[model samples]
Target: MEIITSGRLKNTIKYLRALFIIGLILSIFFMLGILGVLAYAKSQGAPPLAVPQTSLFYASDGSIIEESHRGQKRYWVPLSEMSPTIIDATISIEDRNFYRHNGFDYKRIAGAAIADIKAMAKVQGASTITQQYARNLFLEHDKTWSRKITEALYTVRLEINYSKKEILEGYLNTIYYGHGAYGIEAASKYYFGKSANELSLAESSMLAGIPKGPSRYSPYENLEKAKSRQKIILNSMVSNGYITKKEAEEVYQTNLAFFKSEDLGRERIAPYFQDAVKKELLTQTNIDEKTIEMGGLRVYTTLDPKLQKVAEEQVAKNVNPDSEIQLGFVAMDQYTGEVKALIGGRNYEESPFNRVTQAERQPGSTFKPFLYYAALENGFTPSTELRSEVTTFLYDDGNSKYTPHNFNNYYANGTITLAQALALSDNVFAVKTHVFIGENSLVNMAKKLGVTSDLVNVPSLALGTSTVRVIDMVNAYGVIGNGGQKITPVFIKKVVDHKGDVIYEAEQSKEQVLDPNLAFVTTHMMTGIFDAKLNDYTRVTGQTITNSLTRQYAGKTGSTKTDSWMIGYSPQLVAGIWTGYDRDERITLTAEKQYAKKIWADFMEEAHTGRNVTAFKPTEGVIGVYVNPDNGKLATNACPISRLTYYVKGTEPTEYCMDHVDHYEEVEEKQPEEDPDKDKGWFKKIFDWF
Candidate 1:
């Protein structure tokens, strides 16, 4: 019996020894496999840890205008700024053992692995706070073995590089909270219109329940589902001892007030200006779209909030609310080209099309100034006379014939000066002047003044037939307002990075595109529109637009069958207003409803309230001369009527009035030999002594 027992014991010992050897070999292989994975992770390099940040836009007065973001809206806040309730609730639900684990929960991972193996797919996620942070920062939320391995690798890096508080903070800030919100602060403000530090226990639990399935648990989307998740979170908080059972019960029963979904839509202020800034940033800088959206840039813009408010209010008050007629308003600094105020449409919520910079409509008579300016530059004075009779322009080898006349077919048939032609907005005179200077010259002049739209070089262009944008028209008129210095409109003044360093600063660009004398002469002619007793069509019909603002300003009124424009400027401010329908339909202006002029006058009057009235300065080489109103020539006392007209020194009419030769025949002509100063005028001789 003893020998049999010994044989059994020997067999048991042999089996035990063989089992020990096999276990040792398996352990060695596992260790080597882990070592290989660690080495591979080390060689693969660390994942990107830079967090996406929200960018802010500010007005000139340093007031926040808007906040912009890319794929996810995140407002990073330090852990101290977070309420203890939110931190506790998040920890209770996401990772109760977060403080004790190195980087992951191995027990939970094992359980999850077993469950996933049984299901033959990933059925559960055992990611701790640190692991989730790693995934949110660097990895994607994809369920795959390769993705899991990558997430695990990043998890170790995060724990090693950051502290426990930092890991928790990052996890809370980077987690998705739906509704375009990604962080605790953004979610708090989005859901409750308050800060995270002010969240109550109920609110914290409700917010904490969103990270698991934001869309499914969002109160805005599904109240019952969100309430159910909130209950689960409250129960977890109670189990973890973060809150008492009674407290949890009371908090769950507490009525939670939520922010309206429309509040998010209202967050965007001045949507049109915001869109313009975004486009300009992308086009003018080396920064890419992704960088601008997510790089946490602080953009200081040139928008004047006060002026913008006045513009919006004035437009709403003046335009017909029920009519489909749309209005485009743009105001800017004439010299610097800083856009002070802009209103692209009546209601940005209903329509997002920016008419200020996008829509192209004919300027009608408003374009006459550009033609006359071109003529002035090419040796024509303000007193240059042209016949205002009906004229036919044959273009394209006579394939097209354009018969031009004044507005309402009001023909002046006789001769008219350039100033009268512009004041009357005579199409026939404009066509004659356009033909005299050639079509390409006028187009080039408009281009230099900042008209970028397509301009057909036709005779009708003299009557503002070419389509142009309101912004371009405003900038173009600014050339005349700014004393001939070309200025391009600028929206963003500077762009700063998250570190408070200026990445981009606007350099004011100015070009001497036109002679200062020619600009002054053109401005002087434009002032004729305000002359109430000038007997022109605008005045004779009592459409005298500028009678409201009795200040010394220059402007022009334009109209087409479908569009109405009133663009004017003082020495300090330049504003343009356009009223028209989105579709090309006729807009009949009534006696009381002069939409464009009223809006322009209202906005300009408000804009110039506290500002000084500075007169347009005339440059050197320009002299004021009293000329015959009947015929554009040097006026004498014998002439029935005469007015002070400005002209370039050499371009003024040299000859005396010949139409009234009978009246002037009594006075002998002074020969050059008899009078040494015969060529100079009486005013010129008086100035020569000085």
Candidate 2:
């Protein structure tokens, strides 16, 4: 019995020694932890923390298109602008003790811990409004202990530095309410279209409910769920002494009055122009954000809303399913180079291909105008003669010879004047003229006219064998309208940031592309193609063309084997149109007209409706003249019936063709009766004259 007692005492001593050793090790560990915390706290107190920078995008009209943070739509407003109802509702739902508690609400945290421990699942939340705001602004949404610790630290710091009002305002502005919205101002605009000051009690409650789960309570996402969540927020507001019970019940019974902003998330009519404008914005502003997240941006663009709508409607009406041809078009104010309209494709949903700015297709015979202009610039008058016969161009000694053909197989073997060649779009005539003018000179002429493509100096290029875009073509046509001055197309007029600062402005300038005399000669030649007196129909074939032409205007038509094209201009406007398969297939050909002319006609008609009907002022360098049809020179009685044409001052023909040089004479002009003297006069009608 004495030995057993001794062993028990020895065992007790051993146990006490082990406990002392363990306690010493734990104390050392605790000291190390405290030292580490003190060192970290000291380091943090002396430096500013690095945070992520946000990028922004703007429209041509200077509206914001996007901001950098995902699911964040912050439109910062001063605390003075915030509504009292919104303030109360937010505080009641987020944290009623926000005014009294420091960032770390020890009582709330202990209560949450107790509840979580009882439930055996992590289902409790202890974050105050200030804590949540700090986390949202500076910390990532991580469900880890380390992230929570950082959130608590930042919240404490924020409270120490800022007033309650400032902290509340920050909380209201930085919290997410879903649907890519961030701040109270943006949320108010998203759901109500107005400022936060305009929110009603019901609306405020509904917005307050969204912070917990945006998708679950979004009015656009689910109205029933949103209403349910709103009730919860109202009840919480009443319980937290934010509002009386009677007031809470009254507001809860009221349905939310939603405000939908017209400009906030809507797409523009001409997406191609918008896309081009956006790309320019990125290059100029160094903005790298995607377009979807851009809030309400007031984009002051160059697009004429009226013309763009007409172009869209025309494509929808004319591009039938059988043809499957898509259409692209662009219009611009000729004087200022402002783009009026742009249509990227038939529909943006089926394909987002921007045919107007990106697609490269052959210009076809429309290219003839440039070739003709090149000849005129190089001292060739309208009366310059060339044969319209089949001729073989040299390619290689062993290969089949290259022979250009006219649209119609028949041709005149004798000499044809330059005016006649252009009016008929004769392939052989243009190719021969290009050969004489030098390929480089012709290409330079095209480039001067605003053609942006890399053009090769090949024989086929005379017939527009080179590819070009609709925007470039429209601007090229504007060169003629500006009296030989070339202007770069302008889509964005100005870009202003959210703070109302103009960050960028469009640079508009014009440079002379050709001698005014040469441009006039080209314009004069084009006038013949659309002469009302020349067509069997006494009136113009298209109302768009007729209405746009009170004075001198110039334009040309083009058709590759598959696609059809038109680019033209008045003194005020330049427009281009193209119709072809999106996949580059031979779907539109022979007899049936494609969407090209229809879209062009429709867009122009609408664009010119309210605009001033003005004529192009004839420049001092040009002159009008009457000439015989058989020759581009002075007419004689022996010459066939004649029509009038114009020419540049020193470029008129000296004499008629040899066949009719001495046989014709000029005729005197005649005047019409001043009035119809019929019995339909007022006084005569009273007398019933028969």
In TM-score terms, candidate 1 sits at 0.72
Q: Give the per-residue Cα lDDT of candidate 2 at 152.
A: 63
- Residues 219-315 of candidate 1 have per-residue lDDT tens digits of 9889899999999999999999998999989998989999954365656667898889988999887778877788778899999999999998888
lDDT of each: 0.83, 0.72
| Deviating ranges (above 4 Å) for candidate 2 | 1-129, 156-170, 178-181, 189-198, 212-253, 258-285, 289-301, 394-401, 494-503, 532-553, 582-584, 591-594, 628-630, 634-645, 652-690
Shift in Å, residue 2, candidate 2 = 46
| Cand. 2 Cα-lDDT | 0.72
| Residues 1-690, model 2: lDDT tens digits | 456687898999999999999999999999997667556645565212212322344433444444445545566566788889999888887788888886667898899999999999888898898788778766599889998788766776676666788778777777877877777887998898888988888889899988888888888889899888888888888888878888888987886667666445676446677677767667765645443134333345676666667777767776665656777788888778887778888777788889888998888877888888888878887777788889978643436456898764667777767777776667888989888888787788888888889997788899888899887888777787677776887766775554346666788665666677777778767765555433321222233345444444467777777678877776667788887877678744553343566566556666677778775565788776666644576664555556666678876665654464442332222223355556377887777655
- The regions of model 1 sitting more than 4 angstroms off are 1-38, 50-73, 76-128, 138-147, 160-169, 177-180, 191-268, 271-305, 345-353, 393-401, 491-508, 533-543, 589-593, 620-690
lDDT, residue 679, candidate 2: 37
RMSD of 2: 10.6
Give the Cα error of residue 42 in candidate 2, in Å: 12
Tell me which residue pairs clash in candidate 1: none
